[model samples]
Target chain A: SQTIHQWPATLVQPVGSPLSLECTVEGTSNPNLYWYRQAAGRGLQLLFYSVGIGQISSEVPQNLSASRPQDRQFILSSKKLLLSDSGFYLCAWVKTSGGDEQFFGPGTRLTVL
Target chain B: QKEVEQDPGPLSVPEGAIVSLNCTYSNSAFQYFMWYRQYSRKGPELLMYTYSSGNKEDGRFTAQVDKSSKYISLFIRDSQPSDSATYLCGPYGQNFVFGPGTRLSVLP
Candidate 1:
């Protein structure tokens, strides 16, 4: 079994501010990690994904970026935030060489004003 | 058109009622089908996973995949209020591609 954790849980940021949201996974080695944003009533949009430490692939062009500093530590960052960035941010992980079903974290609720 | 499509329904149903949720896609290469339940403002939790076209059941939940039509379905028997959430259908390949999600409310 695997567990995914994300923080700050909830956030309120002003426009043009810097942002950092962290996610970590336990009980798995070299797993694939992903960052997703969910707008009101819309499906999740993949921001970035990493197959291994320091390897990232961006799904959409945006002001947001992701980094995998460690095998299980993934960080989503923005140098300057936009109001459009406010949404439910989720971190998901899948087995590296197995199933495609994603395990998701509790998620971070961000409100940008 | 998007690769996957789901009706974003605020579907209201009474307790003990049967619930059906569906999604369709244009891609046939997708071999993995998954269903996830998402509470309001929370991350989605996977409920079912199916490979290719087939039918699989787990307790009160049944997931069906129809590759011939590029469609997938989830049926909940004796639904409960606790089942209220947005349901998403995902067709995964190298990665996962998800539907917009259908919001379900099992009213008690």
Candidate 2:
């Protein structure tokens, strides 16, 4: 079985501070990774997606960026955080076989104050 | 206009009642439909996936997709309090277009 791990489960960051959130998947290789943000009572907003290492596609332009440093390790980072950057971050993985069902991690709740 | 539209309902229903959740899409290219459930402050969990235009049933959950009408539905039989969460419908093709989601509360 494949499992995704994301941390820290919750984060509180000061405005203009740096942000880093990590997500790692086990039991799968060369999986498609995606970063999504969800606001209160809102649908998910796709931030970035990577089909392979060092390859990322940004859906919406913002302060946040994503990187796939390894085959199963994806990281979301920001040099300086903004108040609008606060939201629940989710990491998801999909098989390369064109299956649309994506498995998601527990998620990280970020609050920029 | 949005690619997909869903009623953002804080729908409250009694336990054991039947629940119906729906979504409409403007794109006909979406051949795959899916329903996801998300708890408070958690990631969305895929509850059901259906292809083309038809109905698929898994246990107490039934997913229906009508590509002709560009509409989809999810039906929960004998709903439980544990089923309280936000239901999001998505249309899949190159990627996915998700609806705003509907929050359901099953009162016990």
Candidate 3:
């Protein structure tokens, strides 16, 4: 069975602070990884997606960036956080073969004060 | 118009009642449709996935896709309090697009 893990399940940061969130997948290789943010009562906004190492596609322009440093490891980072950057951040992966079924890790609740 | 749209229903229903959730999209190129369920303050979980323009059924859920109408639906039978959550619709391709989740509360 495959499992996805995310760290710092809850984060509270002040404005202008640096941000780093990590996601890792086990039992799968070459999976499609994605980063999304969900605001209260709002739809999810796709931030970034990576198909392979060193390849990242950003869907929205924001204060965040993503990197696929390893095949199973993905990281979302920001140089400085904004108050608007606070939300429930989710990391999801889909098997390229399965294509449509996406598995998500327990999200990180980020609050930028 | 947004590529995908779902009613942010805060919909309330009695237990054992049938529930219907729907989404509409303007993009015709979407080949795969999926439904995700998210509990409060949790990540979304894949509940149903369908490719063809037909119905796909699981134990208590049924997912329907109508390519011609560019619409999709998720139906839940014998709803329970545990079914209270938000339902999100995703239309897929290179970048999966998620609709605004519909919040459902099943009263016991």
The regions of model 1 sitting more than 4 angstroms off are none
Candidate 3 regions with alpha-carbon error over 4 angstroms: none
TM-score of each model, paired residue for residue: 0.97, 0.97, 0.97
Q: Is candidate 2 or 3 superior in DockQ? A: 3
lDDT of 3 by residue, B2-89 (tens): 9999999999999999999999999999999989999998899889899889999999999999999999999999999999999999
Evaluated with DockQ, which candidate comes out highest?
3
Q: Could you tell me the interface RMSD of model 3?
A: 0.7
Cα lDDT for residue A78, model 3?
98
Estimate, for each residue in A1-113, the C-alpha lDDT of model 3 and write its tens digit: 99999998999999999999999999999999999999989989999999899999998888899999999999999999999999999999999886668889999999999
Residue A101 of candidate 3: its Cα lDDT? Answer: 83
Across A25-107, the per-residue lDDT of candidate 1 in tens digits comes to 99999999999999887999888999999999999999998999999999999999999999999999988888567999999
Q: Report, for every candidate in turn, its global Cα lDDT versus the true structure.
A: 0.94, 0.93, 0.94
